[model samples]
Target: MTGRATPRSGALFERAQSVTPGGVNSPVRAFSAVGGTPRFIRSARGAWLTDVDGHEYVDLICSWGPMLLGHAHPEVLEAINEAVARGTSYGTPTEPEVLLAEEIVARTPVEKVRFVSSGTEATMSAIRLARGFTGRDVVIKFAGCYHGHVDALLASAGSGLATLAVPGTPGVPASAAGETIVLPYNDRAAVTAAFAEHGDRIACLITEATPGNMGVVPPEPGFNGFLAQTCRDHGALFISDEVMTGFRATREGGWGLDGAVEGWTPDLMTFGKVMGGGFPAAAFGGRADVMGRLAPEGPVYQAGTLSGNPIATTAGLATLRLATPEVYAALSATADTIIGAVVDALTAAGVPHAVQRAGTMFSVFFRDGAVSDFAGASTQDTAAFAAFFHAMLDAGVYLPPSAFESWFVSAAHDERAVATVLDALPIAAQAAAKASA
Candidate 1:
């Protein structure tokens, strides 16, 4: 297949760069990792995206995992339209917010919930609540587990296992980074050591329910349970950031895979993505006692003017209601078909690769081993992935622009969408092989 023409997209990008940094609001959308012009999508429906150049492609990114039912789902659209007609934002509480929060609490382990405008706000507020509830200062997190760009959480691990972290980015102050302890993912000993050394000062330990930012590196068996127990022993809160995995990974989110089965639950859990139904909505919730510490109830003050916008909440409620067990079953089956085809194609092309999954969410790493930590995830052949990515994009499959991100599938991914991806895989695999050579 010939590469699709993207002249209009290229033109728009040139114009955008004059005003916006990197010509994109988000870093990954810039396609810097893949070395190409990013497609400007004009519209999306079900499982396909129509770019500004009038070229159509099967959408595998699914708006970075928020489109669990696919883009512009009819029921979700209707809900949004109705919400907009009623009014966009009202500073006072709305019924949709209450309904959405109830839906979230029903599916997950959270007993109470507080809305936020984005995943970053959800995580940031949860951390503050943790600090206030425990009267402690230090926070522990794992390397590569992105809990949004929160200042304190944007930290890099120091030289030793339990050493204090340094800022992962330039703007985060040293004092903010000093309050965080960054450790390796899936390394229980490092977590134990960190807690052992700083237990008295530790307020909480936050981690992704499954690390999707580093391409779906799942927690080792019983790893989450271990973290929960360690935090409990040390009197620190355990927070599970499910912004990506919530509702998308499974009906109950990543907690369904382990915490629910293992009879353990996080003290505080953060949610976004699918819960927002592709709108700007997110939340943090947990035991009522811990949540009670927030402002208007207790001392810890956190407020947002547009936190529970009715339009976002209404879309979320509709999406959750439509996401039945059957929808998830179809998503799993579609993911299985695509994963098998990818493995087969890569093997035939003599490409080394590792495909890891967390429930329905998964990613392909351009290497041959199991990836348990960010260090392992980083060892992927990114050049090879970049080649593969462009090959697939050229063949009309819109995957995530970066290699280190999960390829999302929605319930709307029917046989036709799956076939489009299958047809592109072998060629993309050969491209990856050539890059490796």
Candidate 2:
């Protein structure tokens, strides 16, 4: 398949560069790593994006994992339309917020949830609440696990930071960065040591529940459970940052893969992406005791004018209501088909690759062996990935532009969408092999 010319996207990008930094709101969308004109989307429906250039591609990005049922899902649209008719935002409380919070509580381990406008706020507020509840200052975070661009968490974040090959970002005060201890992911020894040295001063340890930021580096078996136990021992709160994985990876999110089975839960948890149903809603929640420390209740003090916006909450609630066991089953089945084909295609093309998965989320790392941590994930041949990425784009499959991001699939990804991706894989795999050679 030959992609339609992106003349309009090229023109828009040129215009945008004069106004917006790097011509994009998010750095990763610049396609800096992938080396191509980023497609400006015109609209999206079930499993496809129609770009400004009039090219239609199977959407594997899924709006960075928020489109659980898929873009413009009918029920979600109806909910938003009804909500807009009632009113957009009110400084006062709304019914949708309460209903949405209750839906989250029913599915996950969180007992009480506080709404936020973005994943960053969810994580940032959760950390503050943890410190307030514990009376400690230090926090632990895993390298390559991006909670968001919250100043402190950006110290060694993955996602855009990794794509740009930036080390700890500048502008974050040395003092603020000093408060966080960054440890290699999946390394229990590093975690134990950090807690041992900073136990009394440690307020919390935050991690991506399955870590989709650094290309889906799944926690080693029992790793999350161990972190929970170690934090409990040290009197630190364990904050699971599921901003990317929540409700997308599974019906219960990443916790379903481990915590649900182990009968343990994090002291606090952050959620975003799928919970918002393609809108800008996110949340942080956990034990009622820890959450009680937030303002209006106790005194940690975090507020947002847009917190629990009626439209966003209505969309989120509608999405959650539709994300049944059948939705998850479809996602897993679609993922299995695509992942298996990708492996076979790469192997046939003589390209060394490793496909890692966290529940239904997965990524194709351009290297051999298991990528269990940031160090391992970092070794991927990004040049080869770039070549593969462009080839797939030309073939009408939209993948995440960065190798350090997960490929998202939605319940709307039917066999037709899966076939579009499968048809592109062998050719893209060959392109990767040629680039390496």
Candidate 3:
């Protein structure tokens, strides 16, 4: 392990490529975005991933924000183990779903919630519900916000749109994306123009309340508010896709912190990741008027075969119950400690960098000051970032693989783990400087 020995992950990659596409289920996991072999994690405990190579890193990715309590808290594991004994999928209604729904309804700005298997499913179905409810065809989304691989959302206009580099993924027909009106994020004027041009036909303004997809760009002050007002004015539903930020954003939730503080309540909200507590559970629901449009209650049809599976519900319930104010407090304090140390380390090393934070969710952008939109975020030095990433990975610190991704802090990331990461920053920053040079 001294000279960076080849991990068993390399072998696994070879074996996996034969069966799985690009040796990864998810495109990002393929390490295609960042040049290298993906680390195959063997197991994890609080705040750390022990890879197959036996290298231990303080995990900041946190399983894309679902391991909020850390890799396998005893309670969550106990909940899952106990649940598996009961059976995995029942394909019928279970009381746990009701309990989870009740818990979710009691928490954020939503009346009811419908469980789905993934964030993609949540947003996809949520859009359908909006289109059905409003009886309109068009949906407006921000330029950089990723709502999953849904056909309507897999759209980018320009050369990138046709080649399918970023937003425009291959396989989705252009007509499927015709109804989607993509606008620059945080640009109120652009949004106004879109609204003015096609307000009547726009069914919903669906956006991440705070977008992490475009390199952790927090919404500009009043941007979300503008979206809410515009949707209200246009008779278009407002859908907040809070899959990544739902619980990790603050002591309450993403909407609980950012949106509620601004007094903007979206018509629909989607939750996944942390709600599932490392399981495949997600949901989208909001004002009764809109949520009621979904099947059984109305004409709009949305159903998942594994929706509200007992294990996922139990995991969600357990995770939610454990994420008390105290846990959020711990997460914030830990994040502050880490971000401060990282900034200080980079500054001392003379590396131009800035960190963006939304509650416990944050990202270290390889540039200075604020990144309010995707265009500004694109200015980040990805090469410098790739060097920093590899340095961190080598130093036993696991950040999000891509520069655009957010680094998550969990309740389980105590002082020890934070210190390991803080210590690694100087080395990473130094490497970043050299790489940029």
Top of the candidates by TM-score: 1
lDDT (tens digit, per residue) of candidate 1 on 164-238? 999999999999999999999999999989988889999999999999999999999999999999999999999
**Scored by Cα lDDT, where does model 1 land?**
0.94
Candidate that beats the other on lDDT, 1 or 3, i.e. the better one: 1
Q: What TM-score fits each model? A: 0.99, 0.97, 0.96
Off by over 4 Å in 3: 1-3, 158-167
Candidate of highest lDDT: 1
Residue pairs in collision within model 1 = none
Judge candidate 3 at residue 335 and give its lDDT: 82
Error of 1 at 229 (Å): 0.6
For model 2, state the Cα shift of residue 392 in Å: 0.6
For model 1, the superposed segments whose C-alpha errors exceed 4 Å read none
